[model samples]
Target: MKNWKRRESFLPVAVLLLLVSLIASACGSGANTNTAGGAEAANGSPSAAAGSSTSGADGKKEEKTEKTKVIWWHSMGGELGKAADQLVADFNASQDGIEVEAVYQGTYDESLNKMKASMDSKSGPSLIQVYEIGSRFMIDSGAITPVQDFIDQEGYDVSQLEENIASYYTFDGKQYSMPFNTSNPILYYNKDLFKAAGLDPDKAPATYGEVKQAAQTLAAKGTPASFAIYGWFMEQFFANQGAEYVNNGNGRSAPADASLVNGDAGIQTLEWWKEMVDSKAAINLGRKTDDTKKAFLAGQISMTLDSTASLRGIVDGAAGKFEVGTAFLPKPDGAEGGVVVGGASLWILNNKPEAEQKAAWEFIKFLAQPETQAKWHISTGYFPITKQAYDEQIVKENLDKYPQFQTAIDQLHASKPSQATQGAVMGVFPEARQIVEGAIEEVLGGSKPVKQALDAAAEAITGKISNYNKTVNVK
Candidate 1:
């Protein structure tokens, strides 16, 4: 009986051991199969391997590709500069391939000088914003790549842009730059000052005679009146009187070596300025546009003629201090010549690699889009470069909120190319402006008669032009 019991116990123990071994073998085989399956899933296909490599060790997918850095040199400063920086940041965050770095190079003149110096050292930024006056210099230097070819290669629709804006950048049927922030002179007035001077706050001067009369009225009321008298402001006044400053719309056609600063239009324009100065109704504070703007904003000047781009500054500076009103720059009595467009464009530098050039072109196109243009225009008070941007519902809503924004746009539509005022392209224009400003100072200071001052200016400009032509080899 004891032997039988021992046999039963041993049989039970043997059965239990067999069951444990079977479970271990099954678990090991299943784990080996899973390991093989995982390896096959990852490496069985090229696309699968690529997908797996893009994930982190923790298995999270990467969000963005490496970005390409792009440098943009611009002249926009203050609030406009901040807005431009924000735009760059937004673009960088929205894309994986491009990262734009915006650097302010001071005023247009300063920016041009810096660009020239940088180009000499072959260390210039990949992109630059150059004023219209410097367009010829950029083209002549052969340092800039024609943007038209890139636009074509990228298949961007250039047809949507206004011809006038586009024409500003075109030389010899090729585009050298892309129109960016374009604006013109406009009449900015203080409504409270107008009312205090016994003039209708809503009634802006529509003609040069009206402007003079308004100035006299304002001065009679002991309200100061001033206007910024830059070369372009004087040029616009002459253009309004149907004067051409140069032949062939300032070389838009044939290459011309001379300037017509002594022409009838130029003389008459100077005479009008002389009358304003002699009457003492207009204050010539200084030649600087910013100084005049400051005077206007301080409520010392009832009105000032300056760039439409200055609208934002005036508004922000005068916030809760005065009501500002803007109007089209007045024309001469019964004369109706259109104004010219002013401001700058973006010029892409040559010598970049094809990929970098393509990336730059992409950025330029991105800036030209209606949404982007509208944002830029509203933020900077610059007129939108694209028609669709101006007509968009959002832009309209914003315009309704600030009607003054329409002043520049309306003036731009009335613009036509004129030789005297389309814009000066002389190599010595900077020097010529200093000479002209000196003559203006002489007239305003009562040191010289208007005609004498202008005659001297004309002689000086003629000599300067001749010298520039000799140096530039202009035929």
Candidate 2:
């Protein structure tokens, strides 16, 4: 084991160490979008030339006699946060002219709010990590200096990045933000439960129909719940069915005025979820995804849908509980698309000192290094964003031990990269998802009809998007 020396951290050890108990909630890859559609791409300006650098506040390079300090604000907690801290230490030690300080700023939502506050106070971090859905908000805010500028200037060949992973972070043929922790959802089930239900332990369900059938079998055998129903998994289902979450290709080309999820895919999915809950085959664990995960770990539920990052936690949690297994997310009978990539990316803010921007760029490049990416993948359960990181020995060993991790790798490989898979690129996606979850609750609770619930969500989301675009002067 590589015993990395402890480094500096803004939070006390007790609070940060508490994250170790949090498990790999993998909420990072959870529903960050409306219908599992978030972590949108931002290619920025495709016309940007090589060796370009969106420079200092004055757009001019200035001299600095002292080492430039670059601040990186992030929301990763627990073990992932520790790994991030180690990464910063490694980079700081490897270079002399630049010092990178990583600040753990609570959750993703909190970090984003803090980042905005910092901007208001003229004290924003040079490098900020935002969740996938924050893509549009960050871009529309106009405070980010696309890292493409630094990549072009440094002539850094980003071809080594995993194409599928990069697809979600790229926009307008331009790379806006650098994708960091990327992952997709997968089906997690108990092998023992599968066998008990007379189902194939090795061949997990691949379609909603199959899942329903398996759930029936499991339930008949006294399995309380088969899977957890939430907006994220529904988002995966929509993508699988080649359904769009919003108009204008998930708001990539122009501002989205309405939601497309109110169509066939949406109705079919929610109806199926209602049947599951009604039949007692799937548990209505409410919106707290962690509770559903606990049910699965305790054998109260037979299967669950979650991000690949949560594999380690489930494995650890299921050690004395049951034999856990993984597979691609269950789709509709004949879906044509794939799941969107969830997880966060790194964005460099504009208008900072030229030296600070350059320093921040340097650290971003360092983090993208194959060695660094490998450490990140192994230490945390996030997928490696670079093609080369898979070749690392440590990564290989990690996967070999936890074969469930391979399910996400295969599923991502099989995914057809499209607008549906890239997720919604609207500025208000963060809020849009809340509306989606609420619709799920209303419809599933039997208080509102599926169509009515979804239509209401669509109306609310459209208003939010329209107002957001107007707020940012989109028109």
Candidate 3:
């Protein structure tokens, strides 16, 4: 196991604790007065209220017709988004006192940025979809409410939800968000290319060594073996092979005190990547490709590792022109270890009125229902977060019709959560990933050795962590 250290300069955690303590103290009496500029009320628009109206038995107005509104910002689009929209609609219709409004907020990063800016300005949607990478930032911001507390306050059954998904959003003993669209990377291959390379299309490579051999064979046959050099993908490869990236997977308080990207496992992983690059079997698609997906769909590359979320787009874009097969990411020498979870979760903002908070919780609960989760998973290629959904007869039946939907679920089942593989919660991780990606590019471009590139990248990340820590107390 990698050494774990809480990031120094505990201001971020301190501030969070202080704010939470203050909120608890101020609201200790359980008073539900509206404060913080009535942002909650502003978000709970009149339309939401109107949409909640219902008729009495005698066709007269119901005596008690109060309704609460929940504004949600999400990045899911297309079929998956529509499925989510329908879930919200159904939830709203099922209850007369809560109306949940779902809005598309562009990509994951865009949604997170919007939420951050809104938090500083003291106004934003009551609920927003945050990628798992944004967990640390959300926790440090003190702008979001912990879902566990909310669940307790509302008397909801936390046990009803899948524990694994719940654990992903938990810090210490409390959960901050509810897992929504969870997924992991899988090996997507072009079957036609496999046949051309004389490999069994049905039998994808089961181990790292086999993958390399296949790549070599494909290259000898004049076909590009693989596409793109994704740092995160490589990180998962190392993790699945029982290697650590940062100490304790960047889960602790301070990252600088626990840097391990230059450790033995890290060095070995980088060397393996270098060997692949040197073999000329894999092509280094520039980070800013006009469209990497386009290249894959067009048969420019035979195999690639990416999020299962890309399934629908690739299948739709290909339009039944090519046979697509999905498999788990291969491990080195048939090594056994679980893959890490990717994708995002939905977080509820703090400072909302009691009524609105209740409504938000209601909507979140609805989203966690097995039917909704299964529908979302089937439509989006993201694994259903709840175990019931995964085992649902409906989902099982649909697997025959849409085989791609099962790949992500299989990968998730094969995954075991670890401090290293569960994922990194460090601040500025998106920026750090870009820096690491750039370093990977340099190594692939023959400008530097893998060890040197990684060392420089680690230094840069450590500097960023130090600078960020200075600005925000982490304790």
Name the best candidate (by lDDT). 2
lDDT of 2 by residue, 261-345 (tens): 6889999988888888888787687775677787888888887787788889899889976889998887777778888888899
TM-score between model 2 and native: 0.86
C-alpha root-mean-square deviation, each candidate: 26.0, 11.5, 8.3
Q: Would you list the rank order by lDDT, best first?
A: 2, 1, 3
Instruction: Write candidate 3's Cα lDDT for 399-466 as tens digits.
Output: 77668757767676667766656555666566566667777778878898888988888887676665
Ranked candidates, highest TM-score first: 2, 3, 1
* Worst 10-residue lDDT window, candidate 1: 32-41
Quote each prediction's TM-score: 0.82, 0.86, 0.83
Best by TM-score: 2
Q: Which residue window of length 10 is worst by lDDT in model 3?
A: 29-38
How many collisions per candidate?
1, 7, 15
